[model samples]
Target: MREINNNEYHQWIKETKEIIDKFPERKKSFKTSSKIPVERLYLPSEITNSYLEKLNFPGEYPFTRGIQPTMYRGRLWSMRQYAGFSSAEESNKRYKYLLEQGQTGLSIAFDLPTQIGYDSDDPRAKGEVGKVGVAIDSLKDMEILFDAIPLDKVSTSMTINAPAAILLAMYIVVAEKQGVSADKLSGTIQNDILKEYIARGTYIFPPKPSMRLITDIFKYCSKNMPKWNTISISGYHIREAGSTAVQEIAFTIGNAIAYVESALETGLEIDEFAPRLAFFFNSHNNFFEEIAKFRAARRIWAKVMKERFNAKKKKSLQLRFHTQTAGSTLTAQQPDNNIVRVTLQALAAILGGTQSLHTNSRDEALALPTEESARIALRTQQIIAYESGVTDTVDPLGGSYYIEELTDRIEKEVEKYLQKIDELGGAVKAIEEGYIQREIHKAAYDYQQDIERKQQWIIGLNAFAIENEKMPEIHRVDPIVAQEQEQKLLELKATRDNYAVTSTLKALKEAAKTDKNLMPYIIDAVKVYATLGEITNVLRDVFGEYQPS
Candidate 1:
């Protein structure tokens, strides 16, 4: 970092002020979601480096530019559309559809039951099976979910936490049955339980036990599944839950710090598992700020890994991430307007250098996207990659004065947050004390106040008025899907060797009682078609459950 000469900057500002003072300004101030003020005009003088501190090249140390030298030039960002709903069979059709439409990877969304480790047959599961996303009660459902899609050929991302290991076990067994080796598997699991406790509220065990499960995955995957991304520490949900952009990066990086420290405590070398770590982020409506946030995220994480963790490998420091357009910004009133919102957000993700992206369907704020809407969302990504010329260069907005300044602001703000979290004893303690939650809640409240005061405009939500906007037909899941799922679980239990199922679950419980990694036991249990609830129940009896205040 270099300091700008104030003497030179003052002279430039004085000379420029005379001509600029004659022009009228629109607003008193312009700022980003993180509340950093943007200058009316950015010059090389505003850059602390005096615009001469050697900016590192792309793929170099600190990775301020990008992780890849040939970002989107040799290969475009992977198009992994998030799609899953109804039963595994139904979701499988959707996955094949997306793949045929030139989607490069698969992103699976589990129904609430599976997310919380419930079998479809559990009384607690009731009407929720297959409603929000795909329901996979056992290996049987996972097999149906993948169907003819070869796991070896396609990378998959499963958004499952708390019971992430169980779901991951199911995925591994499915691939094995497809004759794919575990080493051949490539994908990411949202095994990040910290964010769930902070925002999503889908946790199963206490943070201590939950963290143990996460590190166990880290150990197992490091040895067996080398190509796999062990965890996607997420800021996407945090932003959706209404944190400012700075808070999103701050809290997410803080959580990553906790995970790294936990892994080191487990006696695993940093390089042994750091490269497998990844991130998930939101691409919100603020185009330039969103791009700057991504760039800042990479730079911050690189410094943290190198300076704090003492990681040697460049891969260990690189903050590879997937981006999804913000669902929170979508408006049900002007449902059609969401397409434009998604396009801008998706474009920001690309310009900011995401490894992959998921574009939200315009109708998602209303219901599960219909197939037509999903296709339109995919088309948005395709058009951006092919027709939009922005992908021609790496970090096209990298050198812009506004972008660099904004990126530096976000990076500094995030550092202040990290220092605060450090004083409170890391991410878990900050979350347990509700510090992170309170911060996000306060920001969200302030944002709502701005909207109400007409300081912040939300197009159809605030500025535009529509008295009787006709609503489009939204997709509705068949109520019969739950009953069908329940029957399948019952039939599988009755037909399979019950003794084998019981034995594997008992082994899982025994392993849970000890210091052994639990993934193998989970794999064995799911292989015999043991219900998800049964496997989770064994752990629940051992590790107990987590209930936040």
Candidate 2:
């Protein structure tokens, strides 16, 4: 790679200074734990022209090194622990507890009923309300879930897909009640429905309408909530469902390509909606492989946005993402072993230059994390941020020979997968044809076979011999949580203006039939305190439900 000239170096320093001004670096020594001095970044003694072209400086195009000029130096990645369970009131308390424990952001996990757009009182929602996550039925429930939490103060990521629009509308209405404008909201909604069909099974509508909802979110957020991430095209579920690192990158980018194309087809400018796009990835067991996957993902996304879509803005080309440590890697046999695994995976994510991260709790493999376990998980991030000198530099592992070689290999493999996906007529067609599902199923089955054959070693599982391990206390949702949530919904329905609810539902159903954006209608329905099921039923009537063949 060509050597960076003195003038170029000075220009970069100027930009770095501006970032540091906004987010001052931590006021402490930038040294190793043993007090060994460390540089802000490490570079090779000699440079070649090709190296510079491939791994340009941080914050530059094809952002292989990092996105920001002074990655963690200017500011550390957001520590967002995913939390939610039981009723909205209970989840609200947990959110407060996590914030007090030093979490920088909130990642909400909604229950199955909320995810699929059913009211807590719906017959289909019986016995499942607040089981896996917090159950939200209407604006009343959303208001309770975020009770005292100011939306403008903390970024919140909601893991909702098919019903993302309705939940988002409810959130917006709640913020308005708190005097927080839509423009001030900063967070992401996992609004990518394609992944639900591919790996997860939380999908509601068919692919055509699902794509429409995603692009509508892109369009609405671009015009109103500029700071909000419209859709977090996710590979976390794919990896959890048993995909290789290369498959993770390929499938994610393929889905992203499909989203961008759909938005463009709707007459939306690529740069307008692309800048708000975000990604979600999983950091798995292999230390170096996880880091390489993140770097390779960024480089591939940058090139695709700029070269394929002709994106003009720098933000549009930059691939910002949030990383969560692999839930699949956790072991139920020896739960404490998961802490070590999570630490390794978390470090890899930081080293790979993630903008935000959530480290899984040690007890998550067995159940929802207890308060004590959640604190330990948050402390894991705190220890790494404050003590571990990893945050002192940008892309600490960027120049490692193994990392570089692995990154290149992952990128090439992803390109091959993307080419195949394109040939299969993009992500939507690939899913419709069961091509993507088959690939992930095969990989998952092969992985299981390897573990059974002792070809792969998972500590405390196939390799380690442990007997009668004592179980730690796990968080359990109250059995009466469903009854309480159902009662709350019943009370809401009894008091709310039935006439207004009926009117809004009618308007929403009509809007869903036309090509017009449905965000405004959704917002209107939510404002009238229409339940999630009520709003979704309107859409389900217009757009038939999706059933996997």
Candidate 3:
């Protein structure tokens, strides 16, 4: 395609508007999810930068096009559906079901107790075991979770932070039991504790101690697990907590920078660790804006690594991320409509060049998704990859005039936020001083206000709402799951070697006090069937809990 000159660009816009003046526009307000105005028409004149400077070829520097040269042509992005619930046995059933239904990889979601480092039988874990996700108290449960699944064949992603290292250790030990070596294993750990502080409240330890634990994993993985993604710096939770798309990218990139600096300060080189760094983002309802957001994120991150940190490796500069459709957008009212909502969001993610995607189920708003609904969600990605012609091309919408303009716009806005965060002494200090949190709160408040004022419409929410709509039969977990999990934990404790557990905990505590990497100790404890709670409790004893004022 040839570039339109100044005169041609002006004439095209002028001629286009004259035809548009005859027909009345639908609404006076046309904005993206980030509240950026959408012009009636986008002209080439609006894009001042040359294609070489901003829109490089796929797999090139400042990768606005995409990270992979062939992309879906070489291989389609992994259809990794996030599924885990109830006892590990039940969740294992779901995993096997999903794999049989054509899911390419597995994503594990732990219940609140497992996520926060509590055993099933602990007083703090009562009633909550297996309520939100699969409950894995020890290697005993982890074994059941992946019972029939081949660790070497399947790539798993664990959505656990704060206690991510402990869970990763358990996974490694589980793989070893499967006769798969640690270096052959592949997976992602959402070790993004900074976002836990900024938006999500799942944090257990102080930020400083958490950073130490995170860097330790980075150092350990660089030598041990070459195929593993050590940390999935997440923007999904931040957006779910009510942030604009710009804030999502800005804050996520800020957190990534902090992690890189921490690793560098720990004597790990930029190139060695940066290549393994991955990201997680949210795919929301706004279609084109979401696509532009992903493109902008890739471009911005590539520049940040290469220019800001002097990272010479091409893989180190690439921003490979997994995307999950917006859970916050799903509504209990007319839940069936969520399928269409998820399809659009998933499409946006694919168009945005995500490495993997998790589409939210239609029934997710009511409860945990049922087996049938989860199958439907996985099929959505399958249809997009095989049936839809969009995957035939890489960055399919890269050359669109509006998309290009929007990409540049989002990049500039993200840079502005990053600049402000840097001034506030980077992501960690900004989060500590409540700057990031306050900004997200304000954005969320304004979004809610817009809905209340009917300035923005959500189907079945603010507009086209119905009365006495019969609710869909939602999936419900068995009430016995908690008690069953607790009983299992008690039995494991009674059967395991108590002395080996105590000595391992003592060694872990001693290592936590120093600069030693705790992965080996944690793996040893997991090998002896030590519970997740016991291992985390040792760290708590050494580092103490974080009490936010």
Candidate 4:
């Protein structure tokens, strides 16, 4: 490729301006998150040497374009649709349906009760069991979860934190029951507890103990379950909670660095668990900005792992991520328009070279998606993969002058955030000081104000006025699903060996009090049918709960 010099760039910019000047009546406006005006277009003159070096070839230093030579050509991105609700049986059926419909992998979503380390029968879980997702109280529910699915054949992703270690142990036990060894099973557990304290608000233990749990998983998975992604350092939730694209990238990388530091402190080698480190990002509506964010993230992580941490393995430096279309972008007004929004966001994720993708249902703003809506969302990905010829080439937008410039801009912005976070003593201290949370809140509030003031246009929301129309039926969780899950938990508790349960729980508490690895004790607890609440309560007694400052 021929590189443009300063003279040629200036000439091109002048000619472009001349063409724009010919159309005197024409006007253009650039829109950003906070109603910042954008120029009509960007030229090579707008790009600098710093950006040129940053946007180098894929598989080379600073992988701003992509990480692989073949990318999607070698293998299509993993189509992981997030599903789980009501009961294990119900979720299992849904999984089968998704697999039959050509989903490449499974991503599990747990209910609120399960997320915060409560069993279905716990008093804290009353009226909430199986409300948002499936209720997994013990290994029995996990068994029901993967009853028909072959653990060795398909990869599964679980969205859980706080008690993520316990849940991961239960999953391992279930895989073993299916005759699959730990090494053969592949999947990811969203064990990012730092994000919980920063944005999602599902944390149970304090940050110190939470980091220990995270590090234990890293150590455990590195030795055994090599195929599994120990933790998906997530920025999707952080963005959904209202952070700018720059902040999202910064905070996600910060959290990942914290995990690496913790593992190193535990005496684990950098390359040992680093190869399995994966990321989850949100693909918001800003097409170019979102694309630039993903590209910048890859480049930034590669530099951090290789230069800062001196990681040797190529896999350790490669930043593989899963992208989920932005749910927060969906509007309740003119809900059908969300389909178009999701399609554009999904396309950006594909073009940005995500390893996996999840398209949100259009009706998500209204409620949890109905069966029909979820299928439509899945089909959006299918249509993009098969119908839209965008995936024919790798990093289709790699050489664009505008995209390269934006990628450089995003990288610099994210670096600024990292510096600020480092000054605040890393992610944990930043979270405690309310720096990250307050930044996200300010961004969210500013965006909302712009929408209300008509400075930003959200079709059918702040721009185009519409008359009353019939609304689609929203799906609601059956109230009795909670009762049924609670009864199941009770039955399991009644029939399980009481002595084994008590002894396992006691051992878990003792381990929590000491510096021992919690996974072994957790596995013992799950094997003996100790309920989720029982195990968590033991840890709570030793570690105590975290009250947000």
The lowest-lDDT stretch of 10 consecutive residues in candidate 2 is: 29-38
Q: Which stretch of 10 consecutive residues in model 1 shows the poorest summed lDDT?
A: 46-55
In model 2, the clashing pairs are: 1-48, 1-49, 1-50, 2-48, 2-49
Assess the local accuracy of residue 166 in candidate 3 as a C-alpha lDDT between 0 and 100.
Answer: 91
lDDT of 1: 0.91
Residue 388 local lDDT, model 1: 87
Cα TM-score of candidate 1: 0.97
lDDT of 2 by residue, 1-549 (tens): 999998888677677656657865554533121111223333332223366587999999899999999999999899999999998888999999999999999999999999998888888988888988999988998999999998999999999999999999999999999999999999999999999999999999999999999888888898899899999999999999998888998999999999999999999998888889999999988787888889999999999998999999999999999999999999998899999999999999999999999999999988889999899999999999999999898888777756776677778889999999999989999999999999999989988887887767788998785988788888888889988988887898899999999999998888888998999999998998898999999999999999899
Tens digits of per-residue lDDT for model 4, 1-549: 999888987788899888977765443353465222345567766778576587667777677778888787788899988989889999999999999999989999899999999888778888888877899988999999999899899999999999899999999999889899999999899999999988899999999999999999988999899999999999999999988898899999999988999999999999899999999999998898888889989999999999899999988989999999999899888899999999999999999999999999989898778888889999999999999998888889986877877887888889999999889998889989999999999998988887888767899888885888678899888889888887887799789999999998998898888889889999999999898889999999998999986
Return the lDDT, model 2, position 365: 88
List residue ranges in candidate 3 displaced over 4 A: 1-34
Which of the two candidates, 2 or 3, achieves a greater lDDT against the reference? 3
Q: Once all C-alphas are superposed, what RMSD does model 1 give against the true structure?
A: 2.7
Score each candidate by Cα lDDT.
Answer: 0.91, 0.90, 0.92, 0.89
How many clashes in each candidate?
A: 0, 5, 0, 1
Candidate 4 has its poorest 10 consecutive residues by lDDT at 28-37
